[model samples]
Target chain A: MSKTPIRLTVNGLPHEVAVEPRRTLADALRDDCGLTGTHLGCEHGVCGACTVLLDGEAVRACLHFAIQADGHAIRTVEGLAAPDGSLNPLQRAFWENHGLQCGFCTPGFLMLATWMLEQPGPVDEARLRHVLSSNLCRCTGYQNILTAVRTAAQELGKWREGATPA
Target chain B: MKCPPFDYHAPRSQAEALALLARHGEEGKILAGGQSLVPTMAFRLARPASLIDINRIAELDTCRAEANRLRIGALARHARFERPVVPGPTGALLARAAEHIAHAPIRTRGTFCGSLAHADPASEWCCIALALGAEMRVLREGGERLVPAADWFQAVFTTALGPDELLAEASLPILGPDWRCGFAEFNRRAGDFALAMAVTALRLDVAGHVAEARIALGGVAGTPVLAREAAASLLGAPPTPDRLRAAAALAAEGFEPTEDAQVPADYRRDLVRAMTRRALEGSLAA
Candidate 1:
């Protein structure tokens, strides 16, 4: 089987790689692109471990082919930090709240939370809990993760308000 | 569990996709959203020699409201219907059902037509499509045909779609002003495959009598089961609690549910009855 040449922009970086047509986006990100922040728990779509943002919407990286993401912008956990290497609000909140126990599922949670926080208005706790339920974290039992996301949303909200010109 | 090696063709047009499907015939599989196909491939359950990626086909990514129906292109993601993309009762029903699908991320990439094509018995789209009498527009090499939802799904993971035919779009019948719809399902987790599900659409006449009713059940049969007898029982009668319960009980009649490791057949039948009652009551309340 011949490999297909495809180009994708990941974490604001563009790269062209030759991969088999069957190669999943998760494997391509970890192996070809060398961004292993996107973990793969249940290679199937059930586990949300490989969640990433494709064109700003969260999707399971393991469920998509690399070639299918040729012209799309993908954001992984590695991209969550600012260019100055400072932790983003969500990451900082997670750290302060002790959101992770083993840290294996943190990347997926971060990406998912990034997408949720990017939404229009302030997300209520109930809605946030519902959205956060999509991704699983076996160790944390999710209480602190929920608190972290809530705190991050408030922090982001304040930051956005401050950045706005009065 | 990596997918087996295969040739990938990303066609820019539906015509090109159809040509690729025709050329490869049974060896080709249309890749749209890839929610189900990719997972199955990763598990080595399905190995097509060629994957015709239809994501690039611009014409197949649309959701338009026709005068009498909502035309959803094959590549229209499930998330598009999570809200009232199309106004009115049909759109409301679609939004209700779409939110019940796996999750936000899965809904982002999973196509509504892809679910209908995959024909999963536990699929929310399958049950809603059957209840709404949606028509699948299939395109082949030389011609096209419309398969009504009633005749579309054949069995588990099977459809009336021929090997060379590509489902281009689905036209779901719009609900009239008098129509009210509701969808309910029981799953262990929020996004798990439904153990038993019910979708209902009801229209009451000016006299408060049942004018028309469409009830469909999932996870109780090989395909989404349209409760024809149960719906018939509701016709011309007042949608009272008694009538709804009797009709809900009748919905489980003549259906043989297979017992799985987690749930027994009897329990599933009871769920069908209970869900049917809830769906009917909710639809009326809506």
Candidate 2:
């Protein structure tokens, strides 16, 4: 089959690339565009290592075809921080709470947690745990990860309120 | 991993999509949300010679209610279920089901049609559709038809859809007033496919008599199944714990589930009961 040419938006920049009919978005991002922060774990959809935001929602990059993403915007782990390269609030909280160990699964967790915080209401622990269950961590530091989300949610709420002013 | 090579066709309209499918026949696969189909492609399980991506067809995503039925265009995003095309009891319950599906992201990209058409027995949509007695509208080269959830789902990983036919839309009967619904199941992890799942809908008459009761269980059977005998056992009675237990016991009467690592059949059998009991209690709790 002939290679299919497609354009992908990554980290706020558009890049053109020609891919085989079925190269997964994960492989194209890591190997073709050279965005290495996105890890590959199960190579199946089960592991969240290849997690990325496809149009602001978390999805398994490994399970998606690169050509299928034409005209879509994607955000990976590398985009989490400030444009000036300062640590994002979530990254700072994760560090403060020791939310990650071994760090293999941190990117996926970061993406998942970031997306979850943007959701409209108070995210209780049970709800947060249920959302995080899809992402597996070999480090087994779930308690810390849970702590980080709580901290981030509180911090985020305060930050938003402060920005709005009385 | 790379998926097997295949020519891609992006159909801009429903007519074009129908034409493409009819011409390609069984060799073409319709791409809706790609939440499940893409993964299967990576695994080399389903390699269609041609892929017709229907994302550009704006009409298929439209949702509106006509008369007593809600017409959800097949390509409607899963997130659309969170709101009402028509304000009613059934729409409210469907919103709840949409929230529990996979996760925030999956729901955003996954379409209502793709989820049902993918027909994973463990899917919440399948169970909800069955429990609510929803109907599907499908289109072929020269014809269209309606298939109820009961008739639509035939077996594990299979639907009654013809290869050249496209699911145009789904029609759901708006649940009437006095209806109560409770959905419950446990997956090994959140957003994972359910090890076993159940959705219960109950309606009580003016005198507190159970007027209508519908129960569906998934992941424990080949399809999202309506517990017929179980429903028969509770018809016209007060939906009490004892009646719920009797209905729950009938879950194992018709089918046997296969053993997988996350959950064995014996465990699923127990979960089916627990979920049924809790679902009934929770529905009544409302």
Candidate 3:
């Protein structure tokens, strides 16, 4: 198959790569672009381990073809840190809350939460739990992950009024 | 797993997309949201020789409300319904049902028209289409047709859509103030397919009696099944708790559920009854 050369803006950095239509965005981000923060747990869409932001919306990177993302802005866990490499609010909250046990699903969670926190309106605990349920973490029992997000939402003033924590 | 290699064409217009579909015929597959198709491709269950990606066709990405209907274009993603695309009870019902679909990431890219075309028995949109009597606007080279919801679905993963036809849009009634809609689904996980689901739309006359009722069930059969007899029983009757329960039981008894090892026939029947009752209660609330 002939390789299709496509340009992708990843973490605000533009890069052009040649890939076949069979190549998924997750594989392309990890291989062609050499950014492996987007993990692929299930090549299919069942697992949310390959979650990333496409044009500011969280999407499963494994569900899309690289050819489909030719002109879109892609954001991964690598983009979640500050310029000086300090942890972002969400990441810092995750660390403080002990959100991860094995850390395999952490990247996808970070990217997914990044999209959630970037939303304009405040989010209640119900909305937070519902959104965070998109990705799975086998080891954490989900309490800490939920707490980490709540903590981040509080620090960023995105928590909804009168909503109590679970 | 990597998808099988295939030729890719991103058409910038519907005409271009139809032309490509016409050229490739059965060898081509239209890539809408790819939430369902891509997974099958990754599993190598479907290996089309070419992919006609219509995402770049900007005109197809719309949800327009006409005088009495809402036309959801092929590119209207599921996430669009999260905010209630239209006003009134119909939009609220769509938003409620959309929340039950797969999680945020999947919903972000999954298209409503694609789900109708894909025709998954457990798809919430399929149930909605059946219960609401939506019209599917199918397009092809040089021609187009509207397939009513009753005749659109054929079987599991199958629809009335021809190999060369593209499901361009789905038109649903705007549902006036007299109409109230309700939807209830049961699934084990947050984003798993529903085991059994029910969608209902009821219109009451000035006397506050049920004038019209459409009830549709999903996941218990190959296609979304309409509870015609059960809906007929609701005519001219007040939607009291006992009346609704009886109708729900009748709905559950009318259909033959497809049983799997995990979900037996009796359990599915029970779910149908429960979901139907809950959906009816939801309509009353609406």
Position B13, candidate 3: lDDT: 98
Error of 2 at B242 (Å): 2.5
| lDDT (10s digit) by residue, model 3, range A1-166 | 9999999999999989999998999999999999988999988987689999999999999999998999999999999899899998999999999988899899999998999999889989888888988888868548999889989999999998666654
Give the per-residue lDDT of model 1 (tens digit) for A43-159. Answer: 998879899999999999999999899988999999989889899889999999999889988999999989988877677766686677889897955989987988898877722
Alpha-carbon shift of residue B26 in model 2 (angstroms): 1.1
> Which model scores highest in lDDT?
3
Show where candidate 1 strays beyond 4 Å: A158-166
Tens digits of per-residue lDDT for model 1 on B114-215? 999999999999999999899999999889998999899988999999999999999998777788797889998888899999999888899988888899
Question: If both were scored by DockQ, which would come out higher, candidate 2 or candidate 3?
Answer: 3
* lDDT at residue A114 of model 3 (Cα atoms): 90
TM-score of 2: 0.91
What TM-score does chain A of model 2 get?
Answer: 0.91
- Of 1 and 3, which scores higher on lDDT? 3
Best by DockQ: 3
List model 2 lDDT by residue over B204-252, tens digit each.
9998878888889887877887877777788887887888888888865
> Per-residue lDDT for B199-228 in model 3, tens only?
998899999999999999998999999999
